[model samples]
Target: MSAVLAQAPAAEAVEDLAASLQEAGTVAAPPEDADAAIEEIGLREKESDQVIDKSDKKDPLYAISITSFEDPALELGELILKGLYEMKFSRPSKIQAASLPKIKMGRNLLAQAHNGTGKTCCFVLGMLRIVTPDTTPQALCICPTRELAKQIEEEVLKMGKYLILHKGIKVKCILRDERWERGERITEQIVIGTPGKIVSLLNMKVLDGGSIRMFVLDEADEMLNLGGLGDQSKRIRQRLRKDVQTLFFSATYTDAVKRLATQLSMDNPWSQIEVKREHIFNDQVAQYFYRTNGVTEKLERLTEILSVVNVGQCIIFVHLRDTVEQLANTLTANGHPVSPLHGRMEAGARDKVLVDFRNGTTRFLVTTNVLSRGIDVPAVTLVINYDMPVRKGGTADPDTYLHRVGRTGRFGRKGSALNMIHDEKEMVVLKQIEAYFDRQGLIKEIPPDTDGEEFEKILNVQ
Candidate 1:
């Protein structure tokens, strides 16, 4: 069997993600008892309802305002619309309401929406709408990681379930270990995969890009900024027709990423929707910091935290792969059930770890930055920065910090992100993150000596 095993979610499991989206909902009203962090990061969105179309037109689609999920401007097919509502999506989210119309218009899109803004549906719905359902690979979505690719494939299947049954729509996730016999061709109507696999297929003539109409880059910032992914992604685009409707979506973007995105659109007229920095962090996730004396104290504090708070699911992010193993062993020896995941693991083992984590069989996961982006688990209630995210030269990486905390507080569910600060050096990194987000003093500090009850009160963990 191929190392990248192919699997599909059962009909019974589709509602899990559908309910998560319903729980996520549209732009939520601000809470009454807002704190400083909430007040600072949760800016009222006034521009999220509008899309900026750069194309020249007398009657531009830039003004199409879709407040409800059933708006005719979306022009969703009967079965597709039925599946959407069945998935429990009552209305469009801020990003969805803004981007869906442009996608429906088949225009190139560059979107920078925050986490849990239903960005996946924007592209998935558009792909389903444009695809002929003949299973000829008309739409493609490229992700930065295999886990994210699998997650997206599940979303596509769930959202297009009705079309899948009656219209014969198919979705496939391409992974590095996928086996493609000589001269074999892709038959899925919509294909989601990592850049490496997609490029390999394109090179081998296994995935004919001639019929492809839409190209989506999920977590596009990572695709463009990561070492060789940018080149591979560019190669994949080269295989497709020049007129393919390219869509770039990420929670964060640097100026350089913006330039690369524009270039990828082939300088074609494209539409854009971006969130302000103040509105980037989710208000539902309470952020905190704990000061420990050293590594030993940090371990003790971590164990103590697990014993105290009611963690539905927690992800502990360390800076290195070695730390992942070390921490997992330490926690397990101390009577905690935890799983370790990293890039070095084989494809099958990695899949099992993620499957177990998503299904609630595993409550704690120790991993590197591999699981930081686009891997949504609704039950994840806590994120611990066992080690703060830093760039190659030890500078704080604000983009990664955003993604790390984003693991929790998915959609609109309440969650918490607790950062452990052991030394002055680590404290400086935290401050850098605060400065990057312009949220000074927002990450409140929890003294290491706090008792279990006090810790629970601080995090408000349910």
Candidate 2:
């Protein structure tokens, strides 16, 4: 039967070729062969040209040539120029370059860029241009988390150090736990704080909205995700005048966030910008993965990693508060310097942990996603995902995965991300993540006793 099948295929092929030659009045080729002949004669050359032109026109910057900081069109006050020089900002990032010009024109802006691309500076600079020393809360910047609010305040202060805004124009941080006094009006030119705090102050008539000429929302997507919509953001907006120039900035924007931003800005034409790089993973980061089961295996693998990797500063991400404390204790007992941070911790305790980490007193900080977004530590060289984040259908989003890895890489420095997955189900998720990033399998099995000098040599660990 196999011989007959093979011989029948040859006979059929001969008949088919003869039939093709007779039909064409010449030797006819397959459909694909005809297509190749047409293409070889340049029949589709005009179509290829049209495709190239379409692509070029679709590019965001096709007609827009970004101006350098020294461009004649770029204008700045003397105080602002001094502040920029003091902050040591030599050049503007892509977002900064694109948005600053429009912002200087006092246009409402909605911008999207990757983390660490300097979106914070773009809005800050824009606010500085609009805010005067006598202006009362002329610019208001709201962030999702208190940590982010505090960080933004610090950056604003640093960038405006040479200016007299700190003394002439007050900048207050409205924390959630703090209550607004009766006469404690927002007399500052710039106010930076969390949405909850700002909303509370506006509700209590402590934050005057009449003078708010410019509004900035940092991490706009996160603020909406945290449920900062309802009365707080709405009431705050109600107090602002109709002419207020609004700006929304975020690392990533979902459909919901975009809708919220559009409503806030009265459907202004938003500007979208992105900085393309070859790889999202930082080159300075030396990424590695290990397979482990349960808490004991996790601790063992972490111990092995810390013992070998020369990590000057590290952040360990955990899914739960209990795991954070437990890992901190275990690492401390194992002679590793570590600290714990979580949402459940008191505000003072969290502040102290951050201070210690910044001062080099704490070498390792284990926390949840609270430190993932706005917390910036330039020295963080190692980031370890001790436990995979629980997601819908036992799967996590790729954006969340990227944010977790983003903590370590900052200010053009190298960073590493180490993921731990033990079971086949988790391995399946890991494979999906690899496919999302267009990468091959990232998870590897570390053999037992893989901690010797030979292992170090294999990994090129010094």
Best by TM-score: 1
Encode model 1's per-residue lDDT on 344-374: one tens digit a residue: 9999999999999999999999999999997
Clashing pairs in 2: 284-414, 284-415, 285-415
Candidate 1: lDDT of 142?
A: 95
Off by over 4 Å in 1: 1-59
lDDT of 2 by residue, 246-285 (tens): 8878766666766666677664434444433224433444
- Where does the lowest 10-residue lDDT sum fall in candidate 2? 46-55
Q: After superposition, how far is residue 283 of candidate 2 from its true place, in Å?
A: 4.5
Q: Which runs of model 2 end up more than 4 angstroms from their true locations?
A: 1-65, 165-167, 226-235, 275-286, 436-449, 452-462
Model 1 has a clash total of: 0
Against the reference, the lDDT scores of all candidates come to 0.79, 0.64
